[model samples]
Target: MRLLKQLGTVAGVALAGNLAVGAAGGGWVASLVLGIATGLLALLAYRWVVRRTERRRPVEVELAGARAGLGAGLLVGTAMFVGVIGAIALLGGYRVEGWGSLTGAAGLLGVAVASGVTEELLFRGVLFRVIEERAGTWVSLGFTAALFGAMHLVNPHASLWGAIAIAVEAGVMLAAAYAATRSLWLPIGLHIGWNFAQSGIFGTEVSGADTAMGLLHGVTSGPVALSGGAFGPEASVVAVLAGAAAAAVFLRLAHQRGRIVARRSRALATATV
Candidate 1:
C-alpha cells in the first residue's frame, strides 16, 4: 500500500525525468542541467510521498544535518579516490602522460554532479529509504546495492567483474554511508567527489565510459587486478579494499549511533506491539 505508492512515485518521477531530458537532446550542458533539475524534482516528490505515507516532518527532507553530511562526504570521497589512485601510481602501475583540456574536465564535472544528485535521490533517498522501512537495514542494503550494481551492466564497456566491483565498492559503501548518517547529502557529496576525482581530476575512464579530457592525463598499465583493466581504476583491487575498509568504518559509526536496524524478528515484534 504505502510502500507501493512511494515506490511508484519514485519510479514514475524518474521515468518522467529521463524521458523529458533524453527527448530534449541538448549536448552535455543541457543534459546536465536537466538531470540536476530532475533530481531536485525527485527529491521533492520523495519528500511529499514520505510526508503523506509516513508522517515525517519537513525538516527531515530539508536542511537538517545536510551541512555535516556534505562536508563529511566530500572529505571521505576525495580521500578514498585519491588514496586508491595514489596507491596505483606509487606502485608504478599508473603514469602521467601530459596535461588535459580544462574545458573537458569542467564538462565531466557537470556530468558527475548531475549523476551524483540524481542517483542519490533515486537510490539512497527514495528506494533504499522506502525499502528499509519495510525490510530493515541489511535486507534493504543488500537489495539496493545489488540493484545499483546490476543497473551498471548497461554501461558502455561493462563486465561481470566490473559490476561485482561496483556492487562491493560503491553500492555497499554509499548505502553504508547513508546508514551511518541517515541522510542523502553525505552519499551525494561522496558520489560527486569520487566520480569527479576519478574522471575529471585523474583523467581516467569512469565506469567504462569514455571521459572528457581531465586535469591530469595519464595511462594505467599493470595486471588487471591492480590496473582495473578496461573498466578503469574503479575495478582495481585497491579500490575494493579501500571501499571495504570505509564501509566497515561507517558501519561501526552506524552501530554506535544506534541507527542500524535489527533483523526482521525484532522489527516484527515492534510492529506487532
Candidate 2:
C-alpha cells in the first residue's frame, strides 16, 4: 500500500510536469526552465509522499551525507565518462568535426540536469528504496536496473546491445551510487555529469537522442562494436567494461558499510508475531 501510494504520487507529479513543459513549446531556454522547475517540483513531491506513506524522519529522507555524495559522484562520474570517451577517441573511433553554438550547449545542460534529478528520484529514491525495504538490496538493484534499460527500448536506434549496455553501465552504476551513499544526490550528480560530458561536451548521441550542438562537433567512426554505431559509444565494449569496473568498486564500498539489506524471512516474521 505504501509503495503504491508513492508510485502514484510520483507518476502524477511527473505527468503534470511533462504537460507543463510541453505547453511551454520547443525553445531551448523555455524547455530548460520548465525542465528544471519540473524536476524541483517532483523532488518536493517525492519528499512529501515518502513522509506521508512511510512515516520517515526528515533526516532519513533528506540524508545527512548528501553533500559528500554529490561531490564524490561528480568527480567519479566525470572521470569515468572522460576515460571511456577518451579511449574511443584514442582508438580512432571518434573525431572532432568543429565547434558548436552556446545555445545548444546550454540547452543540453538543462536536459542533463532535469533528467539526472527526476530519474534518480523516481527510480532510486522511490522504487528501489521501497523494494529494498522488503525484497532486499540485491533484488531491488537487479529489478530496477533491468527496468531502467527496458524503458529505453523505445528510443530511436535502440538495439539489443544498447539496452544491455545501459543496464550494466548506467542502471547498475547509478543504483550502486545510491546504495553506497544512501542518498539520491550521488546518483543524480553522476547521471548529470555523465550525460552532459557525453552529449554536451564531447558531441555524441545519448541513448540515440541527438544532443544540441555541443562544444565540439564530433563524430564517431570505426566498427559498430567499437564506435557504438547510431546508438553512440554507450554500446561499445569498453564503455560497458569501464562502467562495470566502477560498479564493482561502488558495490564493494556499500558492502563494507553494511548497506546490503537482506530480505526478511516470512517464517521468522510469522513466528515472531
Candidate 3:
C-alpha cells in the first residue's frame, strides 16, 4: 500500500540520516536533524504520490499561508504566554529566575523553528495526508494527532495524563496548523511559537526537557496533577484547553472559506479512481 511505503520512507530516512551523522556523534542533535529531514522527505514523497495519482500538480507550500500563519500564530502565542503567567501567578506557582541571554533566546528560537518545521511536515504534512487518502480526513487527523501525542510518552517525565493532554491539546494545534490555508506552515508557526514561549521564554519545562535558556526560569511548584511534572507544560490541562480552543477558531474560519471538505474529498475520489 502507498501508506505502508510512506511509513517505509519514514524509517529509511531516519536510518539513512542517522547513519550518516552517527559517525560524527551528533547524538540527539543528529537524530533530530535526521528525523526532521526524514519527515520533510516523507511529505514530499506523499505530495508526489498524491499529485500523480490524482493527476494534479503537487501543491507548492504556500508563502502567503506561511506569512499569515506566522502573524496569527505570534499573536495567539503571545496572548497565551501572558495568560499562562497570570494563571501561574494566580496559582501562586510563579517565580522569576533572573535573566536569560540573547544568545540563549536565539538558540531557543532555533530549536523552535527546527522542531516545528520538522514535526509539522512529518505528522501534519506527510502522515496526515497519506492516511487521509485511505482513511477519511477525520480519521487521519485524529489518528495522527493521537500518535503524535503518544509519541511524547517516551520523554523523561511523561505520565498517562500528560500523554492524554498532549494528544488532545497538541492534536488541536496540529490540526489547526494543517487547516490554516492547508499549507502546513500555520500550524508549524503556531507550534513553534507556542512551544518556544512555554519553554524558552517562560523557562517552563517543555515536555519534560529542561529548557537551556529563556527570559524567565520557572519551576513547577504545584503537584504533578496541575503542573505536568517532568513532562513539562504540555501535560497541563491549561495548555490542552488553550491549544484546542485556538484550533477550534481556525477550523471555524477554514470552514467558512469552503476549504474544509472539498479538497480532501476530491483527493479521496482521485485516489480511488
Candidate 4:
C-alpha cells in the first residue's frame, strides 16, 4: 500500500507533465519551460510522497550531492553515446550530412529533461529502491530492467530485439548507477544526457520514436545490428556492449561500497541466528 501510494503519486505527476508538454504545442521555448517545470514538480512530488509514506528524508534526492552527481552522470552518459556513435562510424554505419534545426533540438531538450527526471524518479527512486529493500539488489535490478524494456515496447519503432537491448543497456546500467551512488540525480542526468545526445545532438531517433531533426544532420546505414535500424543506435550491438561494460563498472562500485542488498529471506535467516 505504501509503495502503491508513492508510485501512484509520482507516476501521476509524470503523466500530467507529459500531457502538459504535448499541450504546450510546437514552440521550443514553451516546451522547454514546461519541461523544466514538470521535472521540478515531479521531484517535489516524489519528495513529498516519500516523506508522507516512509516518514523519512528521501536521501536519494537530497540536494547536497545533486550538482556533483548530475554533473558526473551527464559527462559519463554523453561520452558513452559519443563513443558508441564513433565506433559505429568507424564501421561505416553513421555519418554527418549537414547542420540540423536548433529549434528541434531545443524541443527535444525539453522532452529529454522531463522524461529523464520522471523516469528515474519512478523507476529507480520508487520501484527499484523499494523492491531492493525486500527482494535484494539482483532481483530488483532484473525485474525492473525487464519491465522497463517492456514499457518501451509501446513505442512506434519498438522491436523485440530493441526491447531486449534497452533492458540490458539502459535498464540495468541506470539501475546500477543508482545503486552505486544511492542517489537519483546521477541516473537522472545520465538519462537526460543519453536521450538529448541521441536526438537533440546526434539527430537519431530515440527509442524508435520519430523525432524532429536535431542539431546535426546525422545519418546511419549498414546492417540493423550495427546501425540499430529504425529503432536507432540504442539497439545496436555496440550500444549493448558499451552499456554492459558500464553496468559492470557501476555494479562493482556498488559491491565495493557494501550497498548490495541480500535477499529478504537470507537477511531474515541471518538475523535469526
Q: For each candidate, give its TM-score against the true structure.
A: 0.87, 0.93, 0.77, 0.96
After superposition, the stretches of candidate 2 with alpha carbons farther than 4 Å from their true spots are 58-64, 268-273
Q: Which ten residues in a row have the lowest lDDT in candidate 4?
A: 264-273
How well does candidate 2 score on lDDT at residue 143? 95
lDDT by residue (1-273, candidate 2, tens digit) is: 777877777777777766776677756787678767777777788889888976775353375776777677777777888898899999999988889767777777777877887788778888888778777999999999999888888999998889999999999989987898787888988988888888878889999887677788989989978988889888888899988998998899999999999986888645644
Clashing pairs in 2: none
Show pairs that collide, candidate 1.
none
How good is model 1 by TM-score? 0.87
lDDT for predicted candidate 2 compared with the true structure: 0.82
Ranking by lDDT: 4, 2, 1, 3
Q: lDDT winner between 3 and 4, please give it.
A: 4
| Candidate 4, 1-273: lDDT as tens digits | 888998899889888877887786757887778888889999999999999988999999999999999999899999999999999999999999999999889988988998999999989999999888888999999999999999999998899999999999999999999999999999999999999999999999899987888999999899999999999999899999999999999999999999999888876756754
Model 4 C-alpha RMSD to native: 2.2
Q: Candidate 4: deviation at residue 130, Å? A: 0.6
Badly placed stretches (over 4 Å) of model 1 are 1-28, 58-60, 266-273
Residues 217-261 of candidate 1 have per-residue lDDT tens digits of: 978888978989878988898998998898888889999999998
Give the whole-model CA lDDT for all candidates, comma-separated.
Answer: 0.81, 0.82, 0.66, 0.92
**Number of the top lDDT candidate:** 4
Residue 246 CA displacement from its true place in model 1, Å: 0.3
